[model samples]
Target: MAVLLVGTVVVLPSPQSTLAAWTATEYGRGSLQAGTVNPPTNLQCSAGVLTPPTFTWTLPAAGGLTRTGFTWSLSGGFTGGGTLGATATSVTVPGGLLGIGSGTFRLVANGPGGWTSTPVTGTLGMLTAILYSCSVP
Candidate 1:
């Protein structure tokens, strides 16, 4: 008479590692609040043209995440500015931008993974043209 016994067990599946330990962290690292650039911030032009402006800002609270892209600039002659189109939270003033007299305009608000907030400047008025004459003609 004879008898025999055997036992075996194996399990392995985990060899695709290239340095990974950060699941997803981005609580607070992007800030750019209170970026105002409304009508008549400090604009007073004449003969050159610049009196009809409107640019406002005050939506930089991406703590919850909801700002895809936003960039703007208006210094001097103003040439199309920069990066001012994409999930726009607020963007106007693209009608020739007046005759351009004063300069100073900026805004930045981009959230998610990359995060980016902190750049708000205003004060660019250039659009004055008010000539009305009607003496009972």
Candidate 2:
């Protein structure tokens, strides 16, 4: 007669299980659902043919939660740029803050849930150079 031993495997819930557990713990019966901050729309920029440029956009609606603030970022040709706090439906970012020439700007709305899942981004002035270039015949 011969005897054999076998190994058993156990499966565990994924990380997302925490969310479900948290929801149950927080909400009691149902699962907790995370919310998203809406990004500003109607983004536009002034003519950047001159030093610095202006940026404008429509404020995002906060569904039902309170929005804490807005974060604006500028990359390329600028240094040490800052963020702005907003409580208005429309905002116009002056040229001085945007720096000179062209660059990329991203807008994020912050709230209780978190910042916008996907930020809204745009370019100032014009696309000066291509980030990458390849040649093939």
Candidate 3:
């Protein structure tokens, strides 16, 4: 009589398989999980109605994985500053481009994964116009 011993072999998942499973869970066939970015806060303008004033604000945190860029505008109108990468937390508005008088500047951050938050509005003072003029006879 001959006796044979059988051992059980266990197979571990490959890195690719593990990654694929993670991908399927995180980003299934339906859609990828994305995050919305918070609007910039604590807006501030330098010099008050000064030309080439610097605008600063606290950087917003991403609601999910990551945020892509920030869009700046004036009174809901897009400014020439264009889209800024996530690294940027502030931007300077040229006096000429800002025009004259008082206006509201808005900012909203967006993520590449399809997320855009409500825009935050901030007021800026411009010294462009003369408040009053006097004439002597």
Candidate 4:
């Protein structure tokens, strides 16, 4: 039930369904850092008026797991792909992805995981949602 917080990085506590097990992990976690990565915030398009707009965002405050990639998507005409690497803070997607209308975009973080369904402290792994939402005009 304890949130795995390290400095500015904040990993989410276990979901309601996983409480009992997570509670124990919290106590034994020590340095394991087993938990969901908190979402990044403040997604923006620095140059929306131009083709191949550049997207940017503020990374999560805290999560011990290193982000291996980033996935982006939206409800607009765009079908985004995971073209961004772990360290990429900004990227220029294809032209016409961002139409004139406004819509919300989503981005999620990915990392190595031993468990596909869960993130354990055993090694670098697990990612479902470190997915953050953002909007642009």
- Candidate achieving the largest lDDT: 3
lDDT of 3: 0.61
The local lDDT score (0 to 100) that residue 91 gets in candidate 1 is: 49
Q: Candidate 2 clashing pairs?
A: 23-32
Give me the candidate number with maximum TM-score. Answer: 3
Model 3, residue 133: distance off in Å is 20
Candidate 1 segments whose C-alpha is farther than 4 A from its true place:
1-68, 71-92, 96-104, 113-116, 130-137
What value of lDDT does candidate 1 attain over all alpha carbons? 0.49
Ranking of models by lDDT: 3, 2, 1, 4
* True lDDT of residue 132, candidate 4: 22
lDDT of 2 by residue, 1-137 (tens): 99999999999976653443433444356686766777777766544343244456777765734577777776766433445676644334445544335556666777775554357766653333322111111
What's the lDDT for residue 127 in model 2? 30
Scanning candidate 3 in windows of ten residues, the lowest lDDT window is 128-137
Kindly report which residue stretches of model 2 are placed more than 4 angstroms away from their true locations once superposed: 1-31, 48-51, 62-64, 88-101, 125-137
lDDT of 1 by residue, 1-113 (tens): 88887878888887896885888977877777643322112222222232244455545443445566676666666655666443444445554654535555566665555
Model 2, TM vs. native: 0.52
In order of listing, the candidates' clash counts read: 7, 1, 0, 7
C-alpha lDDT score of every prediction, in listed order: 0.49, 0.56, 0.61, 0.48
